[model samples]
Target: MERLVNQDASERNAVEGKFGEGKRKYGLDLIRARLQETSETVIALQFLIMNLGRKLRVLFFKFLQNTILSFDN
Candidate 1:
């Protein structure tokens, strides 16, 4: 269906965007590991770091919001 196609495209875009971000911001683009296992590990670590960064940002924004609200009370 057309709806399903649109949903798939949206999901693909989000995934691709994250990969692009990883390569650009992290050292994903510079990975020089020749072994398959080592390359996989490097990729996994990069994604893990990316996830941790995203989580920290979310937590920071929540803390900022709480601080601002407390001042308004």
Candidate 2:
């Protein structure tokens, strides 16, 4: 029972953290769409952008690592 409670809290925190990040970093907090569909679309696009940014960062690091290695050899 205690383990289950902890797991639930952890999951909730992760979700809340993402919302906070989206609001702070992605302008999610400023959304003022009048329709439900529009609001959902905007939110979805924000998350998509966030995902793309993460992927780009990973690729950038890999590129940097390869560049450094090539210089060493």
Candidate 3:
């Protein structure tokens, strides 16, 4: 159906955007490990770092909000 197609396209765009971000900012395009295991490890680490960065940003915003509120009181 048309609805299904739209949903698929939306999902695909989000996935592709993540890949582009990884390649551009995380050196994903530079991976050169020869062995399958090593390549997998490197990719896994890159994704892990990406996840940690997202978490840190969330935490930082929360901290900043609290700091600003404390200053108001």
List lDDT for all candidates, in order.
0.96, 0.98, 0.98
Badly placed stretches (over 4 Å) of model 2 are none
Winning model by TM-score: 2
Candidate 3 Cα errors over 4 Å, as ranges:
none
Which wins on TM-score, candidate 1 or candidate 2?
A: 2
1 or 2, which is superior by lDDT? 2
lDDT of 1 at 30: 97
- Reference-based TM-score, model 1: 0.85
lDDT of 3 by residue, 1-73 (tens): 9999999999999999998999999999999999999999999999999999999999999999999999999
Per lDDT, what order, best first?
Answer: 2, 3, 1
Residue range 12-62, candidate 2, lDDT tens digits: 999999999999999999999999999999999999999999999999999
Clashes of each: 0, 0, 0
Candidate 1 least-lDDT 10 residues: 19-28
Superposed on all Cα atoms, the candidates' RMSDs to the truth, in angstroms, are 1.4, 0.7, 0.9
Worst lDDT 10-window in candidate 2: 14-23
User: Residues 1-73, candidate 1, lDDT per residue (tens digit)?
Assistant: 9999999999999999998999999968999999999999999999999999999999999999999999999
